[model samples]
Target: YRVGKAPVPPRTSVPFDPAIFDATSSTFYSALSNVDFRIGAGNAGAVAVRFRVAQHGYLRHVDFHIGSGLAGVYQAGNEFENLRFFGGRYGIMSEKTSPAWQFTLIDSEFQGQRNAAIREHEVDLTLVNVAIRDTPVGIEIDRGYSDSLWGKDVRFENVSRAGVIVSAENSVFTQIGFDNAVASNTPTFVRFRDSGKTVAGAGPRYRVSDFSYGLKLAGLGTIGDYATDIQMAPLARMPARRTPAIRAMPPVRDWANAHDLGVKGDDTTDDTAALQRAIDTHRVLYLPVGRYRVTDTIKLRPDSVLISLHPSLTHLYLPDETPAYMGVGGPKALLQSAKGGNAVVSGLGLWTGGVNPRATALLWKAGEASMVNDVKIQGGGGTLLTKGSPIGFGDPRARFDGQHPSIWVTDGGGGTFAAIWSPNTLASAGFHVSNTKTPGHVYELSAEHHYRAEIVLDNVENWEFLAPQTEQEVRDGVDAIST
Candidate 1:
């Protein structure tokens, strides 16, 4: 067994044997680099090639057969570079520890496998300049693991089903490219679990030529694309808007100074109930100068106005791990109006805890004649002043997860939205509008640098996009916008 970095001998034509190379007590190897264990085609699971990275083990420039032997690369906190994994049913499955095993791959390629290229379970995996092609599924991050998966410059070419299936949280994919392949399933390129909050960045030349859907989100977060060709149909517009009732409301109370209701605008305190109290009692709920923490979703009743008293003095924050909004009785959003109503939300900055991908700043389901004005849902980029102070100015932690959104409007319609700025969200469509009874006017809407397409409108009636700006050209599914 070699301890330190040494020039290892090449096993050019030696058939990989499991009994001799197994890292048991009798036959143990410390490290292996620049070794080639090439095996030809054989039956399924006919041979087994196994290697374990002990305390300080490293594997580099190792070659193996494609879809032949049961090759298990088990390691703990190890580095693998320049490794070529050829065809295999389960090409190089990781038998590492759950939630602790860490592996780094650099300049690696897994090609022509019948089954998955790389299957990992509860491992913190990082891939740099890695390519996986001509396989059924490219990479599968198994479930029941809550760790990180980071990849940079990864390419997937001519895969059958899914390119990548992520079941973990806090995953980041940068500059991923897909060429000349059909991801048959809708959202076939990348599919995430409900808890997966991923940040993906693709260059302008990147294209998913034939995929059912580019990204499918089950949780909250955002997807940002600098400029990529996601060739799919747009989302289908709803037939008609199910408009909600419009109600008149009285004036609101001063939330910060309302000590009796225990509405403290301190960043430390959970002000969800106090703010709800203000909403129920007054027609309008005004926010004062302070950082307010909201843990759960605050469902708005009919006929109310929630506005920031001073833009510089108010910061509404939704912390990490905030449950996503699924349905009527499902997860809650920061500010949601499930039942469409006549409400107004304006003049504030909504920030997230930079964790949960399912956290949405504002979800408005308002009826006709509603208005949302001068609101900024600040994520990774953009500067917001609260109470004469610049909050989250140049703060790198101000980013949003790919599944979270700045604003989502559904069901009801006929609302006017003006001056909404949502930027740098990881992978969400900045302003998503669906199924409105009547179309409304949107002015000065900026949804820039989102991972997915920006400003998605579905089944909207006579809705006008006035001075709407986005970072990339919006691409839709086949039946999305071709009316």
Candidate 2:
């Protein structure tokens, strides 16, 4: 009998299976009705019926249909839809009819407690699974792992190398002792102690940079009120060698006259041939105190040193109408050997016309080296000119065009220029030391030429111009002096 909100009539019945049907079925049409239902038997025999209700007011899994007399007599399809199960359990029993069966219930609620206990149980199980999955295990240290002490005393070992060790050796300053030394009375091989303030010893100190160059070793260490002791180191033994002091060669006299190489003092004519003769004989040429005029250019050969007998006051004159007094081949003239190095033109008053600025009173070639001292060069109240074409000025056609007087001195290689006295009313560079490829040369304003190559210009000065001035004024002043 089924009993619920949808109650069935008393005699009404329907075939039922506890496993397949529940009390929620509309077996009873009214709440006030009661009905009896029967479940058919299976193949073996009749089975006892069972009904179980859920807390959520629904019928749970229950077994009823088993071996019975009505086996295979009643058949029901498994497919069902829109079945409600919430409440007390209801049972029905009926006999099979016409090999088929139909349900009678429309809608009914089972009588039981309604709660969400099953959902809560599922959530608890999920939490337990998460806890088990999240538990930590072990850790690993990779090759890239680094700690604060990575670069310290400890280091990774490389076994394949020849001189590699797992542990480091002790430092050189480590303590050492005898094998039989007592454990509590170890003795050190070397003794080291810091000196107190009262004790006498040296310490580090700082110095100012401004006085660094003037500072001396004796001034480095000093005691407060007491003097510091300096211990000098022993000198090492060494081989000795003789060294001599160099002295200047004395002046030679009558050396040129003996060789028939001498210039007349009173002769005002251009003595180019005599000068060339003296130069060819490689003798000391002498131009005694006189105003000897030179018309053409005079070139000096190697191994020939020209010397003037007179001192600074004597005068050697060059006519204002003539061309340059002296012109040595630019780079062609060179001092061949150190012994052959001697040329002296001294005690001469040189005069040049300002109109011919390209004319040089004295020109030295690349290999030629000479010294002019204690001589006066006066430009004839005009610009003294100097110019040299390819034939005269080495391989390159060089032109020197300026009002400023130029005395070109060149060593076949290159040399230096030293100015003794700065020109007045104009400034003139002293000497131009040439590079190896070039030669050294010197350009003087108006000056006397004296002394040998060694110690030349040792004590030479120009009376007319004694101060340094600008280049323009130097050119103009040189021109005025030459004129």
Candidate 3:
């Protein structure tokens, strides 16, 4: 290499090999921008892209197509924007322990195949208008770090498990929406970290529910300050306590129509294919008042408006093994949205034909931007559930054997479940919301004869049960709702 006073031509391309950029390697320095890297799936490196402040390097507009098990490593003072990560285990993984590691992501989208969308370990991070989808977990921050995680206008969609699992202190999350999280073992909007102050908007405020006692007390964290505007909605405004209404069916108007697929809802024939076709084809999928047998689980899309002609007439029948089959070796949801979007499924009677003790009647893995309004979930009231069998504990195989929840809401935040009436005698809890950071409201939820708890909320920061007449039994535990 020769030294020159003339303007040096920039290195237009560079091989993104992990071995060359290891911690022990030379201090690699570059001011590279507008670079496209095709990191092959065969690369078995632990980290995909790592930058060191010692080199004073910055990467921008760098599109990466990484293979499996690789993560985009970042350090402090690095500015990344318009960066797209596809098919990687961890979309963006920052393990910087330095307080000066101020990493910022703007206008980026992380489409991970599995694992966390962004895993930051002891790093001061900020994400503005970033979208993460098709991943299992989103934005996991572990190990106490310097300063809070500042995020605004961020969206997490179609994740399998948790939306944002953080253990960081002083984290600030605002204008964030987590959508379409698939229901799985541990579904949480935010988990682990009990520290940090959160300021949210007014019209949409949160409430704290459920608690833990005994040895878990020491491990329990605080739900920090939530600054909101005045004149918010009342904590408990009871909905109308009348019988289910039969609304007049409206004329077809939405673009996506299910009727074009010949879905005649006769219980004998399998309407799964036709129904699924309609759901895939139209934005607004309509179902007439008829008993439809769905052999397979109907997957929902984003921004889908599924309407039932009448709550009493529009019915969906599930097989003997419902979500129980999900617990077993089969896919169980009668209807589900794996990649959660703003889907509204209204006015339908979902019933299980047989007593498959390990099944789930209705599962919402989609984000909180979805809804299941005016829908009834029922389990076949048989001697099997009433006889009272042994409940399993501490075992994954026996997780839902003798008991199962009628409805399971996971991950998807900002969705509503209004006027949900489930009077069927079930084995487990009536409703279960797990691992959701910001869960939408539930209005007029009526259910009875649950063997276990009525509703179970785990790892939730805030929730509201707006049923004044619908008395609920609170679990006897320590008062764990204080900062």
Of the two candidates 1 and 2, the one with more favorable lDDT, higher being better, is 1
Instruction: Select the stronger candidate by lDDT from 1 and 3.
Output: 1
Winner on TM-score between 2 and 3 is 3
Candidate 1 segments whose C-alpha is farther than 4 A from its true place: 1-260, 323-331, 384-401, 472-483
What are the per-residue Cα lDDT tens digits for candidate 2 across 1-483? 233343333231355333333333212111111222234433333313222121011111222222232211111111111122211111121221111111111111111111100111000000000000000100011112211100001011110111011111122211111111011011111111212111111111111111001112445475222222222121132112111111111256534641245554343555555655666775455555554444555555554445544322223333432444224323211112222244444434343333333344444442324445334333221112222111221212222232233343433422222122222121122222222333332322222111111011212222112111122223233332221
The best-first sequence of candidates by lDDT reads: 1, 3, 2
What TM-score would every model get versus the actual structure?
Answer: 0.42, 0.31, 0.41
Clashes of each: 52, 84, 30
lDDT of 1 by residue, 42-111 (tens): 6555433444442223456577664466543533334455678776676667655321334556567787
Cα RMSDs of all predictions?
Answer: 22.2, 55.8, 24.5
